[model samples]
Target: MEAQQKIREQPVDLAILDIMMPGMDGLQLLKSIRGSHHFPVLFLSAKSQDHDKILGLELGADDYIAKPFNPLEVVARVNALLRRVHHFDVPAPPPEPEAKQLVLGALTLDLKECVLYVSGEPVMLTSTEYKILKLMMEEPGRVFTRKRIYEAVWEDFYMYEDNSIMVHISNIREKIERDSKKPEYLKTIRGLGYKINAPAEN
Candidate 1:
C-alpha cells in the first residue's frame, strides 16, 4: 500500500520488487503499476521456478533475479536497465516548419499520426513494421543493416536475429509493395542488409 502510494505521489525512476509479498503479490503489484506508470521494474524473488520468472516478465517486470543471488549482480542489472532507459529518453523535437509528411513516388508517411499511404490509399501496419518502414523512409535509398534496424526498433543489442527482422520486412512488403516477390521499394542487399528505395518518377 505504501509503495503504491509513494508511486502515486511522486516520480519514480526505478523499482525493485519481490514476488512473495504478503497481501498484494509482486505480480499483481506489477500489473497495477503498469496500468499507470512506465518506470522500469525488476523482480527479486525466492521462487526460482522457470514459470515464476517467465510470469514475472510477462507481467511487465524488466528483469528477474532468483533468490540466493549476489548483491553485486543485482546492482549490475539495475545499472544496465537504467542505462537502457536513459538511452531512450529523447526530448521532443521542435515543431517542424515544413509539412509533417514524407513522400516517395506514390507512398506517403504521415509523421504526425504515424500513418502510411500507398498510392493515396491508407495502409495499415503493425507498430513494429511501421517503425521499420519509417526508419528506412526517413533516409530513402540508404541500406539499413539488420543489426541497425533491430537495435533501432527493439532498443536492444542485436543477437543475429535475422529471421525476426526478415519476417517483419516480409510482412511490410506484403502491405506496401505491389509484388512482395519482386519488391518495388524494399531491396535485399545480399551479404549486407536491407534498404527501401523510392520509386522512379513516371
Candidate 2:
C-alpha cells in the first residue's frame, strides 16, 4: 500500500516488478495501473517458462527477465528500454516550411508526431511496433533480417527468437493492412527476411 501510494505520488519513468508480490500479484498490479501510467514495466521473476514471458508481454509489460539472471543484464535491459522511450519522447525540431510525410501506399507516417495513418485514418500502435514500422518505412524495399529488426527496435542483441518479431509484425499489419493475410505494404521474403514496398503509382 505504501509502495503503491508512493508510485502514485511520484513521477515514475519505469517500473520493475517481481511476480511474487504479497496480497496483489504483479500482473494484477500491472492491470490496475497500466491504463493510467504509460511508463515501461519490466517483470523480474523466477518463472523462466516461455508462457510466463509471453503472458507478461501480453499484459503490457515492456520486457521480462527471469531469475538467476545477471544483475548487469537487468541493468542493460532497463537502460535500453529507457533509451528507446526517450528517443521517441524527445520532440523533433519544427518541420521544414514544406514538411514531407513518409508515404507508402495508403499508409502515411508523420515523423514529427510519430503517428501512423492509413488512408487518412489514424492507426494506433505500441511503441515497439511503431519503431519497427518506422525502420521499415524509412528504408522501403530494403530487406530487414530478423536479427537486424530485433537489434534496431529492441535496442538489444537478437537471441534468434523469431516468434517475438513475428508477433509484433502481425500486430502492426492487423492495424494498418486491410487484408493482413495478403499484405500489400509489408512483405515477407522467405528464408531471407521482411521488407516494405511502396505500391507503384497508378
Candidate 3:
C-alpha cells in the first residue's frame, strides 16, 4: 500500500508486481491499478502454468514473465516494455486500431497529430468524429452500414449504439461539407450510412 501510494502520487512509467502477495494477489492489484488509469503492467510470478499466464494477460497485464525466468530476459523484456510504453505511450485514437490517416476530399488527417485539415482549413474533430471519417476515407464511396460504424467506434467501450455513430457522422458533415444538409463531401445513402472521397489526388 505504501509503495503504491507513493507511486500513484506521481506518473508511473511502468509497474512490476509479484503475482502472489500477502493481502492483495497480483490480479487484485492489477484491478486496483486499472480502476484509475492504465499503464503497462509486468507480472512476475512463480506460477508458470499456462492458465496463470493467460489469466494475467486477460486481466490487462501488458507482459507476463514466469518464475525461473532468466534475469537477462526479464531485463530485456522490461526495457522493451518501457520503450513501448514511453515511445508509443498513448491511448490510440478513439476508433483506430493503430494511428493511420485516410486523406479524403482535399483533407489530410494526421492521426498521430490528431489534426484534421479540410481543403487546407484546420478542422477540429473529436476522437469519435475522426474515427468515423477515417473509415469513410479508407474506402471512398463505399457505404458503411450503421451497425458497422457503431461496431468500429463504440463497440470497445459500450454496446453498439447507432445513435452515437449518427451523431458523429452529423458532426463530421457539419465540419467538412460546404452545406451539411446537402453534404458535398460525406454523403448519406438514404438507408445506408455514409462515405467520403479520397480527394481527386491522394
Candidate 4:
C-alpha cells in the first residue's frame, strides 16, 4: 500500500517488489500497479520461490532477481532496464530531402529546372555541357580525368580521343569563367585531370 501511494504521488521510472511482503504481497502490488501504471516492474524472490518468479513474469513483471543475488548484479539489471526505456521513449529525427541544386563559386546548377546561373545571371547550356558541369559540381575539388568525363557525360565507352572532352571543357570555361585564358573555376591539373575549384572564402 505504501508503494502504491508513493507511485500515485509521483512519477516512477521503475518499481522493485519482493514477492513475500506483509498484507499485499509483491504479486498483488504488481497487479494493482499494472491496472493504472506502465513503468517497469522488477521482482525479488528467494531461490525457493522460482515458481513465484515465473508467475510474476506472466503477471507483467519486467524482470526477476533471486534472493542470493549480488547487490551489484541487481543494480546492473535495473540500470540496463532503465537505459532501454530511455532509448525507446525518444522520438527519431525525420529524414532530410535530397538536394535539388549544386553550387561552386559563382555557378549554381538547378537540378529541377536544368538551369545554370553564373553570378545570379542565367547561362544557357547544351545538354552535354550541362551533364559535364553537373557531374563536376556534384563533387567540387575532385579531379576528373578525360576518360572518366567522356564515359559519364556521353554514357559511352571512351576511346583515346581527348578533343571532345577538351572542347567541352573550353566551352564551359568560356561560359562560367571570368577569363577563359586564366580560368578561375575550371582548372587544368597538370598531367592529372581537370577539377572545378571553388574560390577560397574571403
Tell me the TM-score of each prediction against the true structure. Answer: 0.53, 0.76, 0.47, 0.50
Poorest 10 consecutive residues by lDDT, candidate 4: 84-93
lDDT of each: 0.75, 0.78, 0.67, 0.73
When 1 and 3 are scored with lDDT, the better candidate is: 1
Tens digit per residue, CA lDDT, model 3, 178-202: 7778777787788776777643433
Ranking by TM-score: 2, 1, 4, 3
What CA root-mean-square deviation does each model show from the true structure?
7.8, 3.5, 13.3, 25.8
Misplaced by over 4 Å in model 3 are 1-101, 156-162, 198-202
Q: How many collisions per candidate?
A: 0, 0, 1, 0
Q: Which ten residues in a row have the lowest lDDT in candidate 1?
A: 83-92
Worst 10 residues of 3 by lDDT: 154-163
Q: State which candidate has the highest TM-score.
A: 2
For model 4 the local lDDT of residue 28 reads: 91
Residue 191 lDDT in model 1? 81
Model 4, 17-99: lDDT tens digits are 88889989898998888676546677778844546655666566666777888898788667755653432213434544753
Order the candidates by lDDT, highest first: 2, 1, 4, 3
Give the deviation of candidate 2 from the true structure as CA RMSD.
3.5
Off by over 4 Å in 4: 1-99
Pairs that collide, model 4:
none
Candidate 2 vs candidate 3: the lDDT winner is 2
